[model samples]
Target: MTLLRHTSKEIKDRSALTINPAKTCQPVGAMYAALGIHGCLPHSHGSQGCCAYHRTMLTRHYKEPVYAGTSSFTEGASVFGGQANLLQAFQNIFEIYDPEVVAVHSTCLSETIGDDMPQIADKAVKEGKVPEGKVVVTASTPSYVGSHVTGFANMVQGMVKGLATKKDKKNGKINVIPGFVEPSDMGEIKRLCKLMDVPIILFPDTDGVLNGPLTGKHKMFPDGGVTVEELRDTANSMGTLALGEWGSSLAAKYLDSTHKVPCQILGLPLGLTATDSFIDALRKMAGKSVPAEISFERGQLVDVMKDYHQYLYRRKVALAGDPDQLIALTEFLVSLDMIPAHIVTGTPGKKFEERIREITKDVPYKVNVKVEGDMFMLHQWIKNDPVDLLIGNTYMKYIARDEDIPLVRHGLPILDRVGHQYFPTVGYKGGLRLLEKILDAILTRKDRDDPETSFELAL
Candidate 1:
């Protein structure tokens, strides 16, 4: 079969550059995720605008304060260095926020100006600007190298490298590295672990911190996360499980190097195949059988799969989102017998491409995959070949509306909807959520086309 390609006019270089960019500026989302950890203060080492934009976006999506620090770079600071700005900010945050940990990430401007954040942060640490037992971790996530996904990965690496302690052995413990997933998903993962009777350490947890309920007053740091203790304990884990490709590298590498703990990289637990891999990994590492409760949940997911087979079979979908988001969604789509007619991600990586190819190999039709491609290209191909639904961030909202297709918001930002990060979309519970969204989109589109008077209630 021949694959249809978009013309330059259909996807022009400039106009097609990005009708709506699917991803956000790097450091913000990374900061948002980090803040979910209990007592973490995410510091943006750049201009105030970057920090403001990032905080505003998170607040809009999550309805939280989304606290963070800005270097407040001015003309003098930009050229000379942001050392002073960061030093002041560091002192201010520790004094004010008084969190146990501060996570520092670079913005585009700081990266362009060549600010030495590690040296600056180190100065703060050495001079006692940072308090006792309080830690500061730095990540060089220049936005130009990639998208928010890259920054998230870099920040994860930074956490493991900076905070994890050396020389220890901890039994009945496993390390879980969940990628850029929703806070609700993180909560469900923890819940499942508890039901399985497995002891584990989860990093960068945001379940309550990111999706906290309002009690009238704004908080600088929400009280939920992996804790500084968990970050330090990663090296001592019996084994490490990397959730997705992006956020798993650093911890896995560190554990291997320092603690000699084995690391297993698995896909986001979105579908049956990936979720099974996650549970099985845990069971083996713990030397325990699959708990009855988890087994029943799996059986229920299979029951729904049987029920939704006809509704999902042979459907075509357009997917555009973060790499981990797109990959997990694609895997889930295929499991339901949906064809991802087009897959697009802003972040460019070989593993992203290879994973897509591997997941779709068993499908009957050839699947189209594109990484590092913009939404303009995605829109062009969607026009070239019709699809049943679109799954991704709000950037695809306009395109889906124009084409009269249904769209489901999943992944970072989810600007068009509230509580996406708060809602669960992983494991068996998350699988059911995926099933509901897919069915809703498909049914909604069908209802629109069916004659108003002639449409039947029963399929």
Candidate 2:
């Protein structure tokens, strides 16, 4: 099936509108990145509603308590400035929450008003508002310019700038930035590193925080996230491995320039080739041979791919999500001989289309890829040209139902499903799980559509 059957090959100019965007605003991404740090309170230097929205979405997605502080801006603050409200917020946050660090992220309103965060932080220090050893970091995340991924990148870079130090010699510890994946994905990445005997420092880690077990008490600063001390030690690390160039490499680049930590940017390892590249990189970084356990995992994934080729081969699919995810996912689908007929993402990037085209240049059929595109446009394309499968966030379910097509939930804000918060989709093990889900969706459709006489005992 093809989703853009009626639409012409020639592209048209579009301006002044965006509908059902695949990406979200910046502050939410910054908040998620902040939660990866231990004992750190995320401070929103914007309206109370912005903070509430971010917290609510994160809580819904992760099914855990999401905590953040707001400056509680009013019309007065919006007009003149938010410096006063922020100063008060710092004092109250320290006195009430008492977190060891406060990560401040700016909003569109604050950025538009030109509030200097460093100046206000300095004032708070001079006025004795901040504790003696408490750390305060700021990230300029204006919501208007970029998507949530951009905000996440900005805050991560802020952490490197605000916390990392160079007091000791090179400690030979590798820095691994896992990108804006799930808490479960982060855990799996750490497990893989441990298996390779590689000592790594993973920042913005949210394993225990977002996926914490119920302990009969709610802790504002959950015992998850990167510790302040660990972040300070990142400067002494041997090198950096940044997964997903767009979402996870910004901080690595900053560290490389400022602290002399060599950085390697790689795609999120979602398929066989990508995962092999990731493992190879890890082996080189650790200066160790590939472990038997890791090799066995990779073999298992390949075995599943061979077994499921009958169902996946030649199946048409449409995918939408963040940039890096879409890139790796596209590679995975292509590896299965599945045609990614139509691809779309709300994040604005000139290189996204180019990279995707480069990967699909040899495919048999025409592959449509769009950057800064919305789901509405995708839906319209699907209306004109339908696909056998639709893979994306929960919002894509509506289109699936209307089009009578099978849908596979694959990206963020999966509001209506489970397992995403627990299972990973990065390493070889994750690849098997993703394959299972895709086969389940496609085979279920086949069983439902095939006639009773045509149905066989074996799949």
Candidate 3:
């Protein structure tokens, strides 16, 4: 047998670019995140394929029917203009979907030709298309410029900037920016805020909409999300809490700058430290003590950590996904004594560098971090220096398979896995979720590698 050694010299330049992008297209992530809002219809201002693909991916991931529309851009629309198609789409969607709020986000093709989305939105309103209380919002997301994380930020900002209104302040009301988290994560945030007796508003809230129960009747529109009333009143909130570093920055900054809404930025409520910090921020802002019920949750989370300590200790992991998710998950992995050897995110932004450094300062191994790119280079990095495991979405499965490292599926566009959409990845429950997957991956790898003679029934 020939010796096999991984080398940078053999790491092709195309790999330097992107062999397989870890993040989905900008428009899709924006649409997916938007669909979490209640009574909101997310429309793609590009080819029908873009909208269809996005809805399909979300439907599979959430195991629920996702509602969205396309401008139905054809060759003529591409060359001449998409303004007509978009206006028609707006008309048709309102007639059919009839959502209380319409959110329009653009793709690279539309953004490239310099399609002015906000202008088109204004024109649509001029024609008496959109209703008074039922508002319209738009986000410009050129796929070539940034990753899904950027798209999410753009969409969320559109919601706040376009919809938020200046009004009298609400003493108890708060804004919660959970960042590009799963539907279950959204649910947990709301639950925790309720327990703390803090009135909170989560923009693009997807918990009820995405993870809705399979009632005998299937409604095209799901019921869970931050209502239009909430969005309108969010400007009056006493404070805003952004969950992750990147996801929450735009909403926080926009509210603070535009409406003078006070904002607090924190890490995603993933691991213990991050979650505790998030809770403390909320408690102080609400002027309420951490309730005994939540204290019990912290204790339970610690108990789970202790129970799973042996399985997780020093389990080297490589992660690649959206930037905010990568940073949050990296910190969580390190919390479990797991070495995050390689990290990558497709979202392009300067913010990721600072966030990664701040979180990984205590990491035993300095993780190779990349932001605003694809997974192609990430796979190359893993091939060069193999890790014990991989923690990312379905796109990285081949890398794990080739390297013989068991992979745990997480993050957006999880095509190969299900149930995560309804399963909270925040709070104490999220720790249990992480522990279950980590142990299974490690044990499965051992089962595959152990010799028959030496392999025991149980480790």
Residues 238-356, model 1: lDDT tens digits:
88888887756655776777768788888888888789988998888788888788989888898998897998999999988887777888888888888988988878787888988
Ranking by TM-score: 2, 1, 3
- Candidate with more favorable, higher TM-score: 1 or 3: 1
lDDT of candidate 3 vs native?
Answer: 0.81
Candidate 3 TM-score to native? 0.92
Error of 3 at 169 (Å): 3.3
Q: Which residue pairs collide in model 1, if any?
A: none
TM-score of 2: 0.96
- Give TM per candidate: 0.94, 0.96, 0.92
For model 1, state the Cα shift of residue 298 in Å.
0.9
Top of the candidates by TM-score: 2
The lDDT values for all models are 0.80, 0.89, 0.81
Candidate 2 vs 3: which has more lDDT:
2
lDDT per residue as tens, model 2, 65-96: 89999999999999999999999999999999
Per residue, candidate 3 scores C-alpha lDDT tens digits across 1-459 of 212233232555443445466776778778976886678899899888988888888888777888888898889999988999888888887887788878999998898777898999899889978766567889998888666777888888888888889886564688999988988899888899899988888887888888788769987777788887788788999989987766778978899888888999888888777788889999998898999999998888788778778878887888888776777678788788888887877766777877777777887776788765556677767777778888888767767666678889988767887768778878767866776788789878878888998786966
